[model samples]
Target: MKILYILCLLISTQVFSQDDSFAKEYFKNGDYEKALFEYKKLYAQSSSNINYISQIITTHQQLEQYAEAETFITELIQRVDYPSFLVELGYNYQLKKDMAQANLSYRKALASIDENPNNVFAVARSFQNHTLLNEAIIAYEKAMVLKPDYNFNLQLAQLYGEQGNIEKMFISYIDFAEANPLSLGNIKRAINDFISEKSENENNVIFRKIILKKLQQEPNLLWNELLSWLFIQQKDFKKAFAQEKAIFNRQPESLLRIEELAAIASNENELDIAKEIYIFITQTAQDANTLLEAHYNLMQLETKQSSKENYQAIDATYQELFKKFGTFSQTLKLQIAYAHFLAFYKNDTKKATSFLEKTLELPLSELQKAEVKLELGDILVLQEKFNDALIYYTQIQRNLKNSTISQEARYKVAKASYYKGDFKWAESQLKILKSSTSQLIANDALDLKLLITDNKYEDSLQTALKLYAKADLLSFQNRNDESIALLSKILNEHKTEPIIPQALFKQAQLYEDKIQFDKAEANYEAIIANYRDGILVDDAYFKLAELYENKLNQPEKAKALYEKIIFDHADSIYFVDARKKYRALRGDAIN
Candidate 1:
């Protein structure tokens, strides 16, 4: 009997092996129906290889045969002692979008309280995907409870964070980090982005503080990155520099960190620290990138307090940097910084022009050329050479029609024209720029346009009054050119309004500001001679005489006008000042 049983067992093994090979071939040919036929033949013979059972469900799923698939998976779940195999049935149901069955399978698999991490994770993922979040949370909890050292806490933390359940994320991070502190990188990165974004929301402050405390414990995680970012946000750049220095110390081989430290130090007004960092980076890096960045920062540091010193320091740095690293494209930044320092701060516009033009021979892109041209235009405008400035500014406009830089260039061109006393042309440029897309630029253009737009009629007295008032407002804002341009606009529109005398007086004063003594004297004298009985006549006669004598050296004409104001207008307020200045100009020494 024993020999017969052994022979039957051997025969059964051979038959099952044959059925398995047939099933494999059928599955390989994409014939799920034939594959199912062979697999079921083995299954009917009481051969329950878990893989065969799982493949049966998978084949049925592929054939959209869900009802038959559920029966096999359900029985397999009941009969299989392998927790992983049981957990897998849950996933198969989920694949069919049968959430109800999937949920039932996952819960059933976990019902034994078998503390297996892989099974717990599988169930958790299924619950998470099926929107059974409470069940997913329980699975994650069970995962931790089964094996506290498995270290999937970061995953759980992120899951909570994704749902905006920040308090849960915080608590999970704390507990997870306490369990495995060395494994805090993902949690640290998540907390970094999360707290950084929500740092300003009042309700999230305490939550951020919790993360910050964790960050404090793990100083190696992102101490410098977070510190530097925090200081930069607060505009406390000096502190950012200090933090960057610590980062450089921790990673001394990092030339990039050294360069960043130097730049941040300079922005913070710690020029000495900036210089130290720059010198160190340049020595170690010894390349064009580090050297040029350091040299540029040195120039900026010197320029912070003194322009003459700024010029000397920038010139020295540029010559040395060019000698060392001029072959690199990065050297252009050094050259550009030095040019700006020379033009605006040092007021050595001739040197600024020279430095900027030298870059013309270098390989510069259209955008770079546009930037240089804009700076050069600013230099020319500062020198009171508006025509040359217009050429540079217009070149940029022709290249980029509707860019923000083009809008800026147009604005500068109009500003230069205003300074040159070309009120009409300046006003035209402003009208277009007032419609610019950039808000701040548009607002400035609108203000300047309003300054010139006061004279709506070029030949109306009311327009002249409005223009004069606009000039006064410009003077209040310290916009001297716009003020003077509006004054000229008023003069063109002056048609004997009740305010004509005041407009003429303002024009004389603005011309004086321009140091156009001859024009100032002419405007003052015109007011006094043409509007003798005008309210500003007494004041105009006094001013006209002062300009003629003090600026033009015509004491005799000054004496004659002062005498007219005192003798002809006895009740005028200028009687005292006019008589007093008249005596002084004639060498009377009246105090």
Candidate 2:
């Protein structure tokens, strides 16, 4: 009797497996009618299987047998009292274009949410699958109200976004973020989708208004932070600083956010506001590191805007900071920034070199000393002391072997050699750096290596390559006008050489920096017109398009150029950014 019972159970299990396999294969192949038949057979054998029942209903709907699907789904609802079945029934009627029945069924689905709030996900998901977003929203809201523990604001925000309701979407996202404060990063990502370059955009305006209303109702620190983020997005650093101040006052936290804002403002050339913010940080910061950073940034900002007339004052400011901060290992960055300012801006490499030497005498670790030596090497290069610069760079490389700084030092050694007209040695160093662990170093090494090798063989004595290297060094020394003149010389003197496009591209960048837009545009256009087959052609296209769009305010020409990049340079590195800009300019709905 026991053996007979075991044989019967094995037979039953085998039959069920066969039916499941048959249904899955047909469904995978889109043979919905056959899949429905097999699933129904399986359901008849095991009426308690929810998976089998759901598959049967979905397959019937896929075959456009809506009445059959509705009948099965209604029966399933009666047998199990599950709310999601009602959603399926409504979707069936919806597919059949029976609006009255669909409305009634959807209302029934929402009404069932109170019976079992935990089933809300299934009900809402079913409606979403059928594109009945409003019905989905109602189901989720009803469930959340019935059970206060049920949090579905994240889903609601996504659904609202799909419905083009930016205000409601942001509100739902804010609610979710407030409930789950650890989800701030996720919330910011969702909100950024609706933002744009134009602060006056409808969605942007709506989002700002919603946050402002929230702030007015109950001035939460989160609201202040969000406002700071929005202002940063709008590139209004002054307003962002105000919001940061509000946050700091309300919470009395560290000045990290203010420091970051100051750095960004300085990077964007909002110097006056950045200076004010840095001053505020210098006053407010409690940590020694933060205070030192604030002071260093202030001096760096001053140096960035310094001229020969104001160099003395800027030098004095650095000296004062150093006097107050002292030359400990912790103050290495400040020391390096001061040295760079002296060498590059004040034209006092003698003092800069001496200052760095004294800094190296401090109690320092190997890496800290390596950093000082790297800056010292840069100063030496500025003073045309190529051999001395190479000595420092090589020492760092030998000491900190296999480190990121070592890779940087190796690249600088190659650059110094290139500037000294030692093409063979520079190319050799760059060859080994092509596979460097640090991507920035690798890229710079490859670029300089290419500039040397590509142009060195063009002339027997490498005259053009040497001149280009000198121009690069001059540019590095902040002699932009002289660099531009030298590049222009190469353009006129080496007409047939392959280096002309590169020289034109470099000179165009310098002109752009000088705010000589017409000359820059002419140079970019010359590259496009004359060297369409060159490697820099795509770069020319992108830069020219940016100039027309931003500086010249010619949208049509910019659009045409972007279109060219999209079609012709599909495999270029700038493809993704070009596509994004093109879509934004074409007025596509970004989110």
Candidate 3:
């Protein structure tokens, strides 16, 4: 209880001491009324200061005790007439909102200021306080002329802007920009305001042209971005691209913004904008992976119809891209995309073969290799290389193990045998594959099985000979496309029949005939890759090698297929052509 009493007493003393400190600060700063109030609180206890009595008189005048303060000043005037003190007496009238007397007080102050303009700002502040803005402006102008570096012009400009004097406001912003052109936030806001106002008001619209000229005079990165959007709004893509070059050059971080803009353009099929953006991505992005997604998006957006010509250019583009990205092989999407465009658009069999072959040799997992081998086998079969097609299918069969693709490989093996004229063996394979787990394969196997079964009761040999005769007539007339189409229809119409592979082989040969090497290579390789011990393996290999060597300009490339054929199929029909070409390309001294 005694300790509590002492703590309370100490806290009370501290609070009173703090109040006295604040009272002294107010009194010294000349806010006498507030100081007087604080001092009176202490004076009630034991105050006896003559200065405090003098302060009470000053505080009365400041508090509008003009009658009381007049008597107090009368005695002080007899002792000394301070000019600054006289100004205070006059300013007190103004502080009481008596404008007329305040003006009188300011005039008396100026009576001494003719000898000195140093107090002009103080007089201006008096006029400003009195709501005499015009008079204040005059005084400020005079003071500025005398003391040119007055920091108050910034405040004056702000006042003018608030008063809606736009011309002066515009000039102020221009001055600010001149002093600090790098203050982008302020500059952009000011310019945007100017643009909005001018665009709405016809007479003010001239400001747009003026500001545009200024923008062109200094083309920084922000200016570049702004101008590019401006040009785009004006429907000028070429100019937009030209302007955007500065953005990447000056501010590389802006490339991400460019991507977002380009994506918007691409969605609208603004091909020109999308193209520029895609190019910028490859150039400005820190890593190839950064733009790889955009590349894939572009690949998806690319259609076969409208952008066919663009699709055709994918090979050369990918080759250049490979050079840029160091052929890292991790970008499997690039491989898939390149293969798609090459096989469908370029019709380059050897290129497709080489591409898929290299893809097979990549550090891909078993699943990826299996997937790519399926593509490879299809390409081989399209080129009339049945045996090579069988090799791919058989590998998938062994490698894929329990995979659904492995089940589908069984049907492909049947197709390979049928193409090689092994109808009996092919039909036997198709019978088991008829109940394939895959609906498409099952349907195909069933069709081929049915066609063979249906024909067995009739003159099967005669009907097939007729189909072959009709296909040959189309080929003879150089209607290779029509023949290929016809053979495809036959395969589709009689899918499960033993004659499907014969149709497949004929269609593959027709693709080759029409120089549709990609499709032809697919059919040929499918045959060789899927039907390992099938009959057409020899013919498919020889023809595929011939296409590679002659049409595809691939001596080294053709050698692989030919060597495999000669090594694997000694009793095959095209052994002669395969052997001769192999020797010629390899410079093999054949005994």
Candidate 4:
């Protein structure tokens, strides 16, 4: 008997759900009379269902039965003490063009909030639902004032923003952020809509003044952090550095934020400020790891700005660091960087090779060892020891299978094969790597695969492709002049080949490396004019746009090119960056 009872109950509940769904569907389809009939039936069965009651009222309003809706709401208010029904009655009056009655009903809802502050939630939400912004604001504020423990700053902030009250919105958001610190990221993202890259933007100025005034009233590290962030946004790294220093002075436990700011500055080409920040880190950091990172970054900055004459001094500084902090696993990155510097910068492969091999004797994780081996493989390839380099790369592949480093090692393996003119093997390797978890590696693999497949059959001997690969190898070895000349030969001799665009792009990069911006511009223009459908066209567009913006002082040209990427190549990897540059150049008020 109990089993039969359970089955009956299940069937009844399923019928109930189906009936409710049918009623909602009818309402959604604008079959109001049927919806009203179904809703009334459900309400008859479940008299306490608020959803049914609300839907009945809304359906009546939708059918232009405002008088009926108001009567039903008034009846509900008298039967139940639910204050939100007053809002419904007011909305019905509004639909009927009865402004006086609407105001009276809305005032009754606000008075309900005064009687019980907890009623503010439903009251304000109802007001917002009806697009009554002013009433919603009053409801929230009154409740918060009456009940000190109630907090509705987030809601108030949104309402103020909608009302174009920027100052009040900022204050409310900041107050909410102060109360709930973890929401800082969310608040900043919301605020990002109002500010621009220019520090002098009106909204930016307003926000800065607000933060400054708050800082004066109560000096908090959060304000300094925010100021630093704003300065970084404006590309004013010098001021950002000062703010970061103030933060570090007050809370010297970690240099992580300062380190991040320095990295941002470096990426933005603010090398002097980056160097200064790193130097501060080196001087003030108490931990060996922090000091080492600072020294390493400082050396990198020096290397970037240094000429051949500064190599000897840079080498001495490396030795000084080694003497201070002994060679160990902790200093592995510095050691690897030093090896790259020696091999690539100084062209001392023998010494660089020996140094890395010695460093390999230290205790390290497999991933760490893979990092060292990756660099060592590069040095070996630099020395033209292709087979030896393959051994190390294959070991990493075997040990750390499917990891990003493993994928990197596999890419190196394919690169090594390509450099050695083994097109078939390189293509095979690249084919497998097209699905690499890392987008960068996958893109690179696809590009190389396309390069080989496109040109391998162009000549019976594959002469042009081989020469192109050799040029690529030379570029990897930092022999930019040779690579440029070889690529020029490809352009001159293989003008009709599909490889022309790729060759031109490669040569343009090499020219840029040589500081020959005009030549680079010419090559990029060649690709854009002749090979609009080529895979490298978007790349050419972005590179040329960057050159125009930074090196050539042709902001108008840059803006035009960025506009192309924004509209034409939406799927290009450079789309986001292009859009950002486009907006910045256009002096957009918001990002």
Tell me each candidate's TM-score. Answer: 0.45, 0.89, 0.32, 0.89
Candidate 2 C-alpha lDDT tens digits along 1-591: 423433444565555665598889999999988888888788788665656767888888788877788777777666666666787887788789898998888888887677777768778988998888998899889988899998999999999999988788999999998889899888988888778756777777887888899899986888888888988977889989999999899777678788889989888778999999999988988888999988888888877676689988887777787788777888889889988888888788998889889988888899999999999999889988999999999999899999999999989998899999998998999999999998888888888888887788888988888888899899999999999999988888989998999999999999998999999999999999999998899999999999998899998888888888999999987787787677657765554
Prediction 1 TM-score vs. true: 0.45
The CA lDDT of each predicted structure is 0.68, 0.86, 0.62, 0.89
lDDT of 1 by residue, 1-591 (tens): 423533554566555665588898999999999999888877777444544665787789789887787677667556545454445566677777877877676777676445446667546665565455666677777767777666666667767766767778767775676676665565555554444222244324545466467667776535455556555543455566677777766777657755766666666556776776666665666465565666676666666545454457657766776786663456667777778876776667788899789886678888778888888887776666778889999999999889999999999888777665566787899999888999999988986676566444544433453456557646634466888777777566656445556667776787886788887788887886788876667778877777776678888988898889778988876887786666555544112
The lowest-lDDT stretch of 10 consecutive residues in candidate 2 is 1-10
Give the runs in model 3 whose Cα sits over 4 Å from its true position: 1-143, 151-153, 182-198, 201-320, 327-591
lDDT of 4: 0.89
Q: Which tens-of-lDDT digit does each residue in 208-279 have in candidate 3? A: 344466677875454465556545543456666777776667766646666766776676557766776777
Q: Write the per-residue lDDT of candidate 4 for residues 1-591, one digit (tens) a residue.
A: 423533543555555665698898999999999999999999788655667877899999889998888788888787767778899999899899999999999999999987889888878999998889999999999998999888799999889888878888888888888888899999888877767787877778888999999999998888898888788888999999999899989988899999999999999888999999999999899998889989989999999899999999999999988888889999998999899999999999989989999988888999999999999999999988999999999999999999999999999999999999998999988999999999999989998999999999989888889899999989888888899889999999999988899899989988898899999999999999999998889999999999999999999999999999999999999999999889888887555
Which candidate wins on lDDT?
4
Question: lDDT (0-100) at residue 267 of candidate 2?
Answer: 83
Q: By TM-score, how accurate is candidate 3? A: 0.32
Q: In candidate 2, how many Å is residue 82 off?
A: 2.9
